[model samples]
Structures are given as C-alpha cells and as structure tokens.
Target: MLALYLLAGIAVCLYVYVLSLDGPESYYCRYDNQTHYNLARHFLDTSDWSALHTGSGAVADEAQTGYYPAAWHLLVALVASATGIDMPIVMNALNAMLSGVTYPLSSFVLMHALFPARRDALFFGAFTSVGFACLPWVLLLKGQLLANLLSFSLTPAAIALVIAYVHAGARRHWKGLALCSALSVGFFGVAHPNGLFTVLVFLAPFVIHRIADAITQSTWIGSRNPLRKPWVVWILGLAFAYLVWQAMLYAPPLQQVVLFNNTGNLNLSWAESAYAAAIISLYPEQPPQWALTLACAAGFVALVRQRRFWLGLPALYMLVVYGLCRCSDAPYTLRTFLAGFWYSDPYRVLCCAELFLIPIAALGLATIAAYAHRKIDRLSWKGSLALVAGVFALVNFFPFYQEPPEDQSSEVSGSHFVPTVGTAVGYMHYLMESGYDEGEEQVYSAEEQRFVRKVLEMIPGGALVINQPHDGSAFAYGLDGLNTYFRHIDTEGTTEQSRTIRDHLSDIATDSTVREAVRNSGAQYVLLLDQGLPYDEGRWLIQTGEDYEMGWEGLANLTDDTPGFETILADGDMRLYKITAEESAEDQ
Candidate 1:
C-alpha cells in the first residue's frame, strides 16, 4: 500500500512539473513570485540575506520584512548556485512539484493516523487525494500552492504526534510524539505564516487535551511520580519543545524580519467571506465530476461518523473560513475577520481549509464503501470494483474539468497576478527568446515584462535605479540590477508619510521643498507608469488631488523640464527619468 501511495505521489509530481513548464502567463501577474525571485537572485549575487533590502534600494519596513520565511529564499539561492538556473524557474518548479505530491502524501498520512485499519486508510487516501477542491488550486497559484503543500505536509505529522502522545501506552512513545510535534509546528511556522495559522488552529484541541491530562497527572507526579509515566514525560517534553520553538521565533534575525514594517489594522469584511465561499464552492468553470464529488461527500460523512474529535478539524476550519470571509462585507474588499489579526489574506486561508477538508471528505467516501462491502456478500465485489474505477477516473479527470478561472481584470492590474505556473514560465521564455528591444515602446502582454526589460536595460552595466510602485515593480526590476534602491515611495499613497508628502505637494502645486526632498533621496532614476492619462489622473486625484498635482511639479524638475532630470528610456508607456546634480542644481 505504501509503495502504491508513493507511486501515486510520483505521478502527481510529474503532472505538476509539466504544468509548471506551461508558460509565463498566470492568473495573478506573477508579481509576488517575481518579487521573491528578484530578492532571492539579489541575495545570491550579493550574498547578503540579513537586510530585507531589494535591488531598488527599498528596504522593508519593520512589519513586512519577514512576511516570507527564509526557507524559500534559501532554496532559490541554492538552485542559483548549483545550476545557474533562473531563480523564478527553480522556485516555481520546486513549488509545483511539492504541490503535486503534497495532497496524496498528506492524505495518506492523515488517513493512516486517523484510521489505523489498513483498508480504511488506503481507501481514504486514494479518494481524498484526488478531490477537485484540493487539486486545482494547489496546482495553480504559486504562493497558495506552496503554502498548502507545506501546511498539509506538517498537519498530518502534527496530528500523528498529538495522537501518539495522548494515546500511547509507553513513556518513550509519548516523548517521541512531543518532539515530533515540536519539530512539525516549528517547521510549519517557518514555511509560511499561513501555515503557522493552520498549525495554531490544529494545536488548539491538542493543547486543551494536554492541559487536561497535565492537570490530572499533576497529583500523581507531585513528589515521587514514576519517571517513565507517559503523561509526565509528555508534558515535560512538550513544554521544553514549545519553549525552544518560541525562542526560535524571537531570535534576532527572525524577530526583526517578523516585526519589520508592521501595520496594524482590521481589514476584513463579511462580504469577502461570502465571496470566498462562493469562489470555492462555485466559481470554477466546471463542477467536479460526479464520482469525485460523491466520494468527497461520502468521506465527509464518514469522518463525521467515525470520531467526534475529527469533527473539530472541519468545524474549526469552517469557523476560520467564515470568520475570514466575514472580514469584509464588500465583495473583493481587503478586510480582517478579527481585531489585531494582520491581513494575511483569507482567500489563501480558504485554500488551506479546503486542503484539510479533502482528507476528511475522503474518509467519508471510504466509510460508505466499507459499509457497502459489509452489507451484501455478492454485491461486495461489484461495489469494490466500482469504487476503484471511480477513484481512478475521478483522480484523472476531476482536475481537468475543474480548471482555474481566467485572471480577472482586477488581478491583472492589482498586486496579485493570476496566471498558471506554466504560463508564467512560457511568458518569460518568450520575452528572453524574442530579444525584444527594451528601448522600444511596443505593447507587451504582461505588465511586468515591459517594466522588467526597462529596468534590465537601465542597469545593464550594474547601474543603480529606484522604482516606484514598490510592491511588484520594485521586486521584479531589482533582480536584474545590482544597486537598485526602492524610494519606498508609493504613488498610491499607502503610508501616512507618503500621503502627507503627496498632500502637501499637491496643496503647494510643484513646491520647491518636495523637489528638494526627491533630489536628496539619492535616487539616480525614477520609473512611472502612464495608465492612459485621465483615468490614472482621476484615481490619483481622488486619493490626493492637491498633493498629487503638486508632486507632479517636482517630477518636472526630474524629467523633461528639469536639467538634472533626463528621459533615459521609455518603453510600453513607462517613462524612466535619470537624476543628475550637475545639470539640474543651478536651474532648480
């Protein structure tokens, strides 16, 4: 059974690798992926991983520095070192393969732990591992995909530890369970912050159970308790491990990374929860095939019937899902479900819950199958054969039918670029092979492409540049150049300082003070996108018309009118202005 499961995992990995090879076009514009890739490449080229600085000289603020754990970055750097492969490709491939294998491996572990009976475990693993809800998203969005893989992988391990510690008759087993739980939780936290969220949710029950056990055992272990008592050892080991992991989070570098650029806000809304649920439940182009859908339904029923404890996982997941969904009342608005919880984006959380639910759903299906086999002797062979056939067909065809939706216009323009992993790679390859001139103003398909080429050209000889719209632009362009500095200036006015500066400049309408500030920033170049004039202007005007209009005046000093500022390049509606003190100081 294990060998069969391993083979299934291998097949899934191959399928995902092929998907990763598809193209550069993704549902989301590969903005975050590019950001991580660029940063990783910069780290590799410069061998500096301490500061959360990008090529655009934009340093991460206190809260946002450690948003991504170091593991993914390290992997990218290692691949760059060993094979000289592009960091994007390497990282994408790794994420894809892991995503492909994760569902099956996780399901196998989960089912086996929950159902010690071999037949039950195998049945649940096969059925759940093939579900539509689990497969499609994991195989698509890179960030969510990678996060789900890590979360699923760690979830089973953690659950196993909880089971062993709580149920094992021996002290040694209990100690081992505690150690394993510590490692799993620590690793999960390090992979993705969302994984940490999932781990916390899973740990609630275990923590409660453990606390009860500890209280019960306290009297027994007071003075002359047996050293080998299961509960005593389990409690001590868990306590030690938990403290150790907690300390790791507080380590100097990790703490700095976590707390960097911290912004406290409640950004959730009730509307987002409904929208997310709708997206999960209905938005895909095609519904799951009957077989898999039925199987999942069955597994869900089985899980509900098998153990009361299993119900907690799904109930907690739903509560989180609903809570996160309710973070916003308006559709697509960024909001939070609870106070003090930073916006990790609950859409991704929905993805994680879906992952956990798959195995339970699978168990439900297997339970139905088990019942059928036991109830009738002659029908057993027919039922078993039908179930096996259904599993095979479902796994093979459900992912095909349940295709990811096309990238919405908002996703294209917004920070999230939604594209399949394959499409992204293909787009990159196309750009590289086409040898497209960076100086030309030809329209490019992907927004990042034009910006990436422009930045690449400006810094061809290791020159420094500053990028505006720091979210994607800073990360994407900084990868190509050495001394890139991100002015940390958000044209959209994301921060108070930026908003105040924008407002003051607009009020003053080309104030000398603002120009001086821009000049003094030591930025050699500035990049801006011309989003079809009136609309872009209108949006900015709405955000800060007076300040925005004023800031534009300072830009003249750095652009066509200012002697110090010269248009070095313009491509696909993006304008790059270079700063020079010698030419502009006197004029200013």
Candidate 2:
C-alpha cells in the first residue's frame, strides 16, 4: 500500500512537471481570462473587495455594475499583492498548480474514505484521475474557466470529509469531522455554486443508504427515537454548510449571480443530450478511453456479483446524473423543475459523472490485474505498480518528448494538427500554437500586449476608447489601466449612446446621428485591430458578430486623410486612432 501511494505521488509530480513545459509565464488566453484578470487588477488598484466591478465603458454598463462570483478573482488579487510578482504570472501558476496538484490527491482521499481496505482499487482509481482529460483541457479550453476549475478540483476533498463524518459512528468522533465537513462544503459553495449542487448530488446515495441502515438497525432493536441516529450528524453538518452558503448569499454580488443570472435553459433534446453527455463524460477526447470505460462497467458488475453494493455507490450517482442531464428539458417531468438548480447544462452534469466514474474505473483495472496475476506466474504487486506507472507516463508525455520547433517566437502563433487533450505536450502546444502563435482562441498576442501598454501611456486615465471586444481591446482594462466602449463580449446593459456608436461609428464623417452618438459617448480615441484569427473572422459571431462587423468597417474607413480622425499608431494588426471630431451635429 505504501509503495502504491509513493508511485502515485511520483506520477502526479511528473504530470505537474510536464504541465510546466512552457514555464510559469506562458498561458492560453481566452476572453474570460481577460475579464477575470481585469477584475483582479481592479481589486488591486482600488483595494476594495466589497463587490465585483469592472471600471470600463459607461457607468450604466453591465460590465461596470453587474455582479459576478469573486472567489477566483479575490484569490488572484491576494496572491499578486502578497508576492509582488506580476499578476499574469501569478494567475497562470496558481491556476495550473491548483488543478495539477489538487485533482489527483483529492481523488485518492475520496477513494480511501469510501473503501479503506481496498488499496488496489484506491491506487488504480486515483492513478486514473491523474490522467482525466475532460476538465483540465476541454473545459479549460472552452473559456479558460478558472473559477469552475477551482471549484471542481476541490469537490472530491470536500465530499471525502463529509463521507468521513457519515461513517464516523460515535459522538467523540462526530463533532470534529462534522465541523471539517461543514467547512469544506462552505468553501466549495463560494468557489462555485454549481460545485455545491454537485456535492449534494454525489452525497444523495450515501445519505440514503446510511438512513436505511439506521432504520433497519433500529427496527431490529425495537428502539425509540429512530430518527435520532448517527446519520443525523451528517445532516446537521450539511445544515451548517447551508448556513455558510446563505450568509455569503447575503452579499449583493452573490445574490445577483445566484438569484438572477441567466442559466438553466435547455440546449438539446432528451436523447441527443444523453448521447452528448455520454460522449463528453467517457470519450471526451479523440482516441477515447474505451478501455477505461469498459473497465468501469466490469468493476460495477464485479461489485454486484461479490455483494459489495456499498462500494458501487458511484455507479448509482452516475445514473442520477445521466437522468438529470437528459431529462432537464422534458416538460411536466420532475427533472425539468430540478434541472434549474444544476444549471441544466449536460456538459457540467456529465463532468460530475466523470468524476465519480474514476473509482469504478480503478476497481475494474484492479480486477483485471488480479485476474492476470493469477493466470501469469511472473506478474506480482510490484509489477502491477510498474504497469500503472508506465501507462501513465506513456499516455501523458510520450508524444511530445522530441525536440520542439526551431522558431520559438511568441510573435507568431504555431499550429499542431493533433489533439493535445490533457497531455503535457498538449499544454505546451496549446500555449505556442492556438494562443501565442495563431491567436485562434487567444484575445491578444505577445506583441499586441506590449503595444497595449504603450497605448495606455499615450491616453489619459479613464478615457473611453471605442473598441470591439472580439478584437482584443476588451483586455485594455485588465492588461493596462485603460477603459473601452465594450469591456466584454456580452453587450447586455450597454448605454444607448454606446450602442448607436457601435452600429454607425464608421459614418462619423457624414452621418449626423453617428456624430451625435460619438460626442455623447465622450468623444475620445478608437482602438482598431486586424480581423485575422478564425474567431476574429466569424467563429464566435453568434455572440460578437455585430461588434466585429462595426469594428471592421470603422477600420477600413479610417485612412490617413479620413475626416475627423487622426491615426495615432498603426503597428502590425493593431491601430489606435485619435477621434478629432469633438463637435456634435448640433454644435456644427
């Protein structure tokens, strides 16, 4: 058992080492990352943590006043302040290490809490968790979702403490574990409310089983107060956790997100959602882990055959998650109502299922190893550990072991055709290719970031710059202390003046309405960017097409002799123009 633990620890460390390939400075940029980075910068600049606010655009904008979950932002701010290092480096390092270290250790802790005697299953399950690709790569790549990542990474540890409290069985053992469990649950809630929902879903089966066991024992003894059982301790612990969550919800920011955020709408039909859920949960990446999925099935069958029903709780949890994922859109069904609490997203629901599936997959692998050991004379426990370690190294780091490309310049983005998934090679490739090299999902390139700082120095503080969020000027507030017309991709709650400017800014020379809108929006400079990347062209147009189109036409219209505009800077794909027309149509 000790050797198994040591081997697992070694493998986990190696995984983190692999993730650190591009050093602490390199990060895959996304719009959300920019938004959160700006939030953290705001916190640092003001030293105010009362509520989340982005000091960009007009005061009436949602980006300026709307509330957001702030745990991830707060942590980044606190770390940067304490270390006095750059915020980007701190943000990237902490985000990576949190997922890299917490994930595997939390899986091991949860497996041990559930089955203390099954070392083989525990080892394989936790080992498998070290390679799980869905959350770290797919979900992270979606938006650089740091808050979601932090919440999910911590869920297993929180759930493990609750399970320990559930099985404590005595008054002396109860209070300490119960308090710990409550604190864990409290922390998980503030990290992300979706994670709190996940914890409750995962705990339902265990709580039910424990309550049933308490009832059966009470019946056998003919005891009174059967409701006053050991399971009630877990309930009290959860109640305290609830109190913690409720207290945080008292804050207006949390209230806005929890009570009135846009969530819970169904995106697919029942069967389609179920199929998508299964594919994302089990076969999340290319060359899907069919062997691991089959192993999970085999493990569940073995548990039922061996009459170890308690150990198969994760399978039941998966079933409940599947039902919720697929049935959330079915009108008149109970799930339709309950799905709101879980956010009604199949990806999130199935990600929770995938987390629980880790232990079952481990058990299946262990069962296979045991069978093979019996049949083959040479295989031993040491050999099993070695085999697991070898597999871990091969799948994660083997493909990217060769020499990197010759041109390691951060100015030009690189391209890789193969899937990076969760491998260390994948991590480096993502930073170099999609982010710095090609700017596919990236908001800004290395050169653009430098130019932004120089542009900030040129402009006065608090001056509003006309910008399209998709063109990367949305990052101005976070990366440098400059305001922009659109602070984020979402244009909800924007001022009427800003909206008019967005649609007709290019007609400022001839159109009276465009001139009036620009003057009213605080006549200032314009930040234009080259529409080169796939996203810049049209990939994410559903959300930012209007803004991109407006910016593209404005850039084309602003030549050297264009009326009411003077080009300030035209470096590569980025252009900064000074708005020369302060006179409105009425003034003219």
Candidate 3:
C-alpha cells in the first residue's frame, strides 16, 4: 500500500515538473544544471573521474566540482551512463523523481517520528508528500535547489533517530538508530555541505539534550546513557576510520572549494537583515497570500495544541540562518568567525526555508483535522481535510495556479506566471481557470538551437571562447562543456569570476586590457551575437536577426568595430572572432 502511494506521488510530481519545464514561457536553462550536464556528458565519454569538467577537450582538475559539490553531478552521470538517456531528459527525469520520492520518504519518517498510530502516520505522510499549500511546488519548479531537496528529504530520517535516541537511550537496538544517524549525516554532507550544516544546526541541540538527559539518568541508574554503551567504542573506531579516509581521499577537493569560495564582503545592515529574515519566515520569498497564510496558521495552532515543539525548530532554524547570513555586518569579526560560512544569499536561504516550511505546514493541517475529530463527532474530519487539501492543490496549484485576486500585487507579477483562478465567476469558470496550458511558451527556436550547434561544430576544438555581451552567453559554454570566461552560476565566486572576464571584453575594441584578460584567462575565441538583442536588467530576450542581435546593445558593434580581432565565422545572428597576439600585449 505504501509502495502504491509512493508511485502515485511520484507520478504527480513528475507531471508538475514537466509543466514547470514546458510552461514557464521563459527560458528554462539553468547555468549550473547545464554546466553539470556538460561535465557529466564529458565524464562518461572519457571514463575520467579525476576531473568533473573538460579543459582543452580532456578532463581537467580545474573543474568547478572543486567548488560546487560533485555528488549530484556524479549521480546524474551514473544515471545517464546506466540508462543511456540523453543528458537533459535524464536530469529532468532524475530531478523530478527526486522531488517525487522525497515526498513519500519525508512523510514516512516524520509521521513515524511524531505519530504513534500507523494509520495516522500513513495519512499524514501522504498529506505531507502532497501539500495543501502550494509553496513546495513553487520552489520545486524553480528546479535548481537539488541539494536542499535531497537534504530535507533526509531531515525527517535524521530527526526520527533523534527522537528514537532520546526515548530508547542505550538499548541494543538503539545502536542501529545511532548507525542510521551517522549514515544520514554522511549522506547529507555528501549531498550538500550547506544542507548538512543546516540540518546539524537544528539537530545538534537535540542531540546534546539527549546526551545530557542520558548522563543525568546514568548517575542514578548506573550508566544508562547511550554514550557509555560498548557499541560506542565501535562508533569511535568507525568515526576515526572515516576521518582518516576523508583526510586521505577527500580533503584536497573540500579544501579547494572552501578556499576558492571565500568571497569576503559584508553587505547586510541590521535593519536589512531583520527585514529579510522576517519576509522569509512566513514564506520562502514573502508571506504566503492570506488564504495560504491561514492554512499555515491553523497548522501552527495544531502543533502547539499537540505540544509538537520539534516542529517549531524550523522557525528557529531559519532565524539562526538569516542572522548568520548577516553576521558579517557585526563588529569584532567574532560573530562572523563563529558563524563561519553563512552564505548571506537571501534567495538561497529562501529556497532552504521553503523546503523546511511546506511539508510541516501540510502536516500542520493534518494535526488540525486530528484535533477537530476529537472536538466534534459529526463529520469525518480526516476525509474532509483530505478533500479540502486535494481541492486546494488541484485548483490553485496544478500548473502555476493563481493567487487570490485581492492578494495579487508586485510579488505575484509576470515573473511568477500566476493565473487568476480565484476571480472566476462560477464553477465551470474555475475549471476553465485551472492554469496556463503547457507548451504555450515563446522561448528560443529550434533554428536558434541548430544555429548554436553549427557554430560549435565550426569552432576549433580546445580553443577557449569568450561569449560577448554577457547576457545569457554562459548558455553556449555550459551547453558545449567548453572552457570559457565563466561556467557555473549558482555561486558568488563564479559570478565574480565571470564578471571579471566580461569586464575585460567590454574594453576589447579600444583597450589591450581585454586582450590581456582573454589571454590571461587562457581563452582564445570570442563569439558576438548580433546587436538589437534586448536586455531587461538581467536576462536576454531571444530575437531573430540578419546579422542583427536579439537587441543586445554592445554585441553587434563589438564584432564590427573591435580591432585586433580576426573574424572566423559569420552566420546569421552569430559571429566568431579570434584575439590576435598583439591584442594580448600590454598597452604602453
């Protein structure tokens, strides 16, 4: 029966993921995902595990895996290798399955930890898997927070061990529980260190409390504390072995990432930090609209009524993270030092907060129904709760469901693609208002894709290319797995690295600085898109042209006016150029 439920949940999540990819009406290419895909493709073709990225047509240790965790990339490569599926489809499929499988797995762990009755566990597990509130779907669709998804899915399992350890103490079977906890931490750390750290921030206190309680009990009861168990000797032995293994095998890569990613600058003011913290507290981005807010509040009340205080840990967890995020703003460096490695990224924190929030909010509704059943015997509370949850999901969320008409504002603007489901005149109208149809987007054309491929084919192998104009140009390098000015997009370090490269190119025509920068960065070629390509603050608009850009201002002129560049290819909207050796010479 659980297997059946798991399958159903997986099917629903996979369907939603497809919609997210197909119906965005915007480009769905994530820089990191595509880069990793390119890396994975290269990894399989060469059977080289030494490097996670290609440099000069071969795997190079300078791969970004040294910075970004390689576990997910490796997982993708393994799946692609085993299934013989195309890279993109494998990514979408595996990631969708990750979302799907996490739903059931999380529910099972949480329900078992919190509830006693098997039926209650199953029902709440299913509900948590498919939330009544649509927040998780919102996060999942963005589709870049794969590590957060994986970590939080393991969260319930980790917490379950905490509960078991606290209750079971030094029992023989509890040894298994400790082993499970260790494995959970190991996997969580490998999945994403930030996520593992996030989970630890929540769980560590509980673990300490459990140990303290056991020690207190031990004083009277002659060492009942699990820490005193003989198995602890084995645990220590195993931990030492693991540490030695890490020191021998994993230390260099981890050290490389930590050193590379140290972008030391403080930006958050106290007021700014507090405000950002408060906003993500209720929803990952902002407070959920009033209706969803009410649903969350009901769950809040239910948890409090039941004395399920463990659930409040997520709230506190977010608070600490947000505080640490801005700790760099504080004086004496002590706070920042102690806070060590808080990524200070509002959007990243928002993603993590949402993963922790949505499932608990779903369980919150279940708690309310269970509470209600005890109060009034007239209706089937469970049935009613499920029906309400189901209707809310299908109506408001199925595919970018609309916010309440009154709740609509700047936050729910075009970027969100939220429909107007609440304002529907009647039942049939609501049905008609389900959401946007799939494949209704106007993204880059197939001809544009083919054009990109043809250019890749024509460009000399092992020649590094600098994509001009900096708007969505990373796509080309990420697509082909070629070394370029930039590669990954998920990190601040990578962003700054890419920016520095582009800054040099910005001076290509008049300044030898661009040439020096290109040569210094080990790149040889630069691709210029036709001018007239539109840039709206941060994104590039796909446009058609005859040597005309997609409205990009700098692109077309740079190709024509830029000296010290040798044109290699001119096809439609794209042109390729090689930086001359004199271009690399320092200006006198």
lDDT of each: 0.47, 0.61, 0.49
The residue-by-residue lDDT of candidate 3 on 56-77, one tens digit each, is 2221113334334455656767
* TM-score of each prediction: 0.64, 0.75, 0.64
lDDT, candidate 2, 16-108, per-residue tens = 433443545555556566667677777877787644343433332644454455677788778888888777677766665665666666777
Residues 429-496 of candidate 1: C-alpha lDDT, one tens digit per residue:
23322322323222223455556665666554655454433223444443334344443333432433
2 versus 3: better lDDT goes to: 2
Q: Report the lDDT of model 3 for residue 361.
A: 55
Clashes of each: 69, 4, 9
- Score residue 99 of candidate 3 by CA lDDT: 64
RMSD of 1: 8.9
Assess candidate 3 and give its TM-score to the true structure. 0.64
Ranking of all predicted structures according to lDDT, beginning with the best and ending with the worst = 2, 3, 1
Query: Clashes in candidate 3: how many?
Result: 9
The residue pairs found clashing in candidate 2 are 412-437, 413-437, 413-438, 414-437
Candidate maximizing TM-score: 2
- Better by lDDT, candidate 2 or 1: 2
